[model samples]
Target chain A: MIWLPLVGLAIGFQIYWLPGLSLPSSVAAYLSLATLAGLDSIFGGIRAGIEGKFHDDIFFSGFVVNTLLAAALAYLGDQIGVDLFLAAVVALGGRIFLNLSLIRRYLLTETRLRWRREG
Target chain B: MSTIASPPSRGKGWVFQVTALCIVLGMLLALSLRTQRRAVSEGIPNRWPALRAEFINLKQQNASLQKDLAEYKERYEELLRKQATGQAATLGLESVLQEAKMLAGQIAVHGPGIIVTLHDSPKRDVNETRPEVIENYIVHDYDIRAVVNELFAAGAEAISVNGQRLIATSSIRCVGPVILVNSVQVAAPYVIKAIGKPDVLQKALELPGGAADGLFLLDMIEVKQQPDITVPAYSGSMRFYWAKPLPQPKEKSR
Candidate 1:
């Protein structure tokens, strides 16, 4: 069941990779920032699911809004001569790390408790 | 410990949504990574500043090289101009030298003029064969000099007597029976080749009271208007022991 998302991720990567889709270099910075935001949201969702606070509406809306908002903010910053792309990367990277740590802690705690009871 | 634990079953639907979103994320990540890799390989992102600096350096080098090329082209044209003027001056000097050579009679000349032949008269006294009387019938050095003076006054540019070309230092005189022209001995039937207008030279010698009139009466002179006559170059060496050229007057030195 856990491997289902990983398989889906592989499937999506192949969908773009097999077709050899290309984007302009000018948009690369924003796309990378958006990807970072999406990763952060995924980790946050996983952590919420572990804590029993997962909401389908929030997860779906967050993913869409965060991806679009990150790319748009970076583009706007570029037009206005600001380094908002770096800011977005730093902010989203921090969240991803935090969410990843929390998920790790939750999974480790669950596994240990289950093992102790069984033993 | 139980408070931090996962519930037995919250919502299984979140996993499906998360999977779907992960797929989207995977696609975005693939596209971004591909684009970034391409930008890096193209050397547009990280190496932009260094490449720009090298480009500016190359542009400056090209500008300086172009300036040097322009200067060299200007110098080449200037040298060509100087060479042209120098050649012109050389040509002018060459022509002046040619004219001076002609005037000095140091070069051979040929043109239309008359040839006067002065020999001992063919007529002889049949009744009295006296040597002095025969001498009166023969041509003299004065007769030859008179004929030459007449030719010169008639605009003869060049003249030669018996192959001896006459120059400004030339003299026609007799040493006994031999006549010396330019100090070179010449014999009778003196064929005087004069380069000038043939008709004018002939007419001047044939005038009733001309310098050669007496020789003409005795049949010692024969003036023929030839279409072509050749005057040889002077063969004698000329040198001045005490003559020197005078400097130009200051007022006339324009």
Candidate 2:
């Protein structure tokens, strides 16, 4: 779950560096986002593989979340006067929060359990 | 299978799991990066707003360069098309401009073109208009075309829609009444620039059957040509577009 937030931050890093100014560039930006999203999926796939279950299934969830975020961003941009940049921040920011929650609920909870087992 | 497994081996298994996860994460990060780079090079700057704006600028510059490129391509094609047309090894930008200077006509003039600001009627909403259809508030493609055509006919050699110069392959398309010049959206008051026999071009526009006739239909219109003349360089990228092309007839394979 925290993967989502991490993705957002990474996108933020991209915006801070390479900003686009034209229609085609908007497409380029999307391509970049998709690339990063793909990477995240790959990582997820590898993680799943090690888990001995359907390894690549994690990417499916990532795809759903990213697509929703992309669609929401388009709609929200039109609703408010927010440009793509600001809207991305919002999406990424939301992702970060969700990721943090995932880390807490899953990873951190697991750690706590492991400590109890050891104790 | 684990009945004979040592405690140290179990611990090592945990370490291996963590390491695998780390490697997977690293691979994912690398893949994400590859995607972003490829996207930029391929002309799909679809990331966020900040980069989006920069890409737009690059695209605009690219269009100018593209226009010049098209001019070269046209001249080259013309040479190839004409058996009678003599061949020139480099019919490039520099030589073309140089030739133009050498053949510069005595009547040619330099000046700034008119910028017409046609505001949407106070009651009409531009945002409300369907970009897919024509509407009254926005400027129509035909109007701009008429303006450009009249300018050229009047002897204007160089022209630009908004700040974007019109090269040979430049296209002006209408989405509703909104006209896109060089695939960049522009709104009124439209600033059209031209370099030509200034007096003749102006007189042609002001002629009885010119852009004037269409003004009454417009909520606002203005036209003029002044002498503080300059043509800015195209600053956008001219990337190759493979798709979005019209279907060409394919030959049947034997």
Candidate 3:
């Protein structure tokens, strides 16, 4: 079931891999920031699921809103001559790492408890 | 907060949404990677240093070439200046040569002057039998020489005797019955053409005690002023067998 998302990611990459497909450098920067925001939301969703706190509505809304908000903030920063892209990257990156670590600990404890029960 | 009642269903629902978001992330990643790769392949970042160095080298070469062009232009102007002076010198030499040729009687000349004709006296004493008195009635070589000398003293520019031009080495002498001028035999009526101021030449000949006075009294000479006269060039060639030209002395520096 976890592999389903990885398979979907591969499918999406192939779908965009048509010949002559390209994005301008300015748009590429925003896209990369939005991708980071998407990854952060996915990891946060995973952490919530492991804690039995996952909500379908919240997960879907967070993915859509975070991607748009990150890209929009970065573009706004560029218009205002500020490096808000860097700020967005730092904030989203820290969240991704924190969520990943929490997911890892949760998975590790679950496996440990399952092992003790089996023994 | 409204939490889903079924934990199993909630877990299942989150996976679906996460999977959908991951697909979108993948597309963004692919597009960003493609754009960056294209930017690198365009060579703006990769070849900038090499292009700048080449541009500098070409600029230096252009400067050196311009310098060479300026130098060649200066040299060309210098040669033109030298040629102009050389042409002037050639023109000066040509004029000098022409004047020397005229002085040497190697060319024909014409100007305003007088003509003097001498002939033996037509009047004679029928009974006078003395040879000296008879000789006086005929013109002599001395008479012609005297007339020529007088013309020279009166500033005659050129002189010819009966079409024979007289140069520096000319001689007038009696050869038996005929007279020789420039070694060419000539007969009288002797016509002496002198190129000078016509009035001055005629006055010199008509002076009371001048060289032509005896001939005038005897009716052996006739003088007439002409507006134009021509003197022929010397026909004979001259050669120097013993007299060689002296080397020109170098000019002293001031």
Candidate 4:
């Protein structure tokens, strides 16, 4: 869903407000918020794909990639003295570049529903 | 999520992803806020208690300084006023007191000398501005005691407070709320007569704000010396409890 980036932004803001919060507690709070956002996104993504709507592989790829990248950057920032915001930006930027090229339109149109509609 | 001839790879359910994300983010927010608060409530210095005590001592010293400074200002202003009015111009009395202290110290000291008297000032009228000044007025015996100590510190050969001859085993003790030197109780207006380098002893007495903070409790307290002073035989025992050194921290073998 379009909410992927929104969710990412929301999570960023949450952690930004409380930098020194230990990992376990952040995991707990984000888990609940992410659960609600994730469920809504999954349903929206599935519906759009079935309707031959805009393939959300790009969005899903971006979100997943960005999430992992963000976590890694945060860890790196902890290890080094890099600014957290800059680290987050590097993560988000890296994910956007990897997703657009890797997530293919051919892969999307070859789906089962698309085959049913054409063949 | 895209149309796929086969199907998408087995993706973790939204529930799992959501659960992971929510749990992680919450804990971090709380901790950052806590650490920020800790820094501000305590300043940069960790050894604050001693620093604060020193600060208090300094503030007390400052207050005494301010009192002296104010007196100096008033006297200076009075002199200024006199100079402006064309009255006989001269240096301030504080300087004169300082000079007297220096002169007294210079002229009175070592071996033997005279004993001068320092009595309480004339009692103030009830209508006086500050009542505490009069109510607490007294040549607190420590005034003499402090002078005695200063004389000792200044290498006085012999000393006495208020005409009482000091002996080898003598003590200046506060007994029954009345201070006693050589077992004789002396009241306000005590005189400190010493025999030593008079100049050094007097300079020692007037070395700045007179010893009232930890010594005498009165207004306009001072140390005056006799014209002729001499040192007598002096021997005394001094004792103090000494503390041993503390052990340092060490690491354990793992």
Q: Point to the candidate with the largest TM-score.
A: 1
**Candidate 2 structure quality by residue, lDDT tens digits, A12-116:** 445433543223333444444443444444344333333333322244556546644654655456446567545554555555555445435656677799999
Per-residue accuracy of model 3 over B1-254 as CA lDDT, tens digit each:
44564343444666777788778877766776676667556533321234445776888899999999999999999999999999998998899899999999999999999999999997768788998899999999999999999999999999999999999999999989999999999999999999999899989988999899999999999999999989999999988899999998986941
Model 4 CAPRI quality: incorrect
Error of 2 at B161 (Å): 1.5
TM-score of each: 0.55, 0.31, 0.54, 0.28
In candidate 2 the C-alpha lDDT for residue B125 amounts to 58
The segments of candidate 4 whose C-alpha lies over 4 angstroms from its true place after superposition are A1-119, B1-116, B127-135, B175-177, B210-227, B230-254
Q: For model 2, how does the per-residue alpha-carbon lDDT over B109-220 read when each residue is reduced to its tens digit?
A: 3455543344444545545757544355556777778778878787776677777766656778887647798788888767787776666776777676666455545544
Clashing pairs in 1: none
Off by over 4 Å in 3: A1-119, B1-68, B125-130, B251-254
Clashing pairs in 3: none
lDDT of 1 by residue, B134-231 (tens): 88788788888888888899999999999998899899998887888888888888999999988888889989988988787888888788887788
Candidate 2 residue spans exceeding 4 A from truth = A1-119, B1-134, B216-219, B236-254
- Please tell me which predicted candidate would have the highest lDDT against the true structure: 3
The Cα local distance difference test for each model comes to 0.84, 0.55, 0.85, 0.50
> After aligning candidate 2 to the native by TM-score, how far in Å is the CA of A112 from where it should be?
99
- TM-score of each candidate's B chain against the true B chain: 0.74, 0.43, 0.73, 0.38
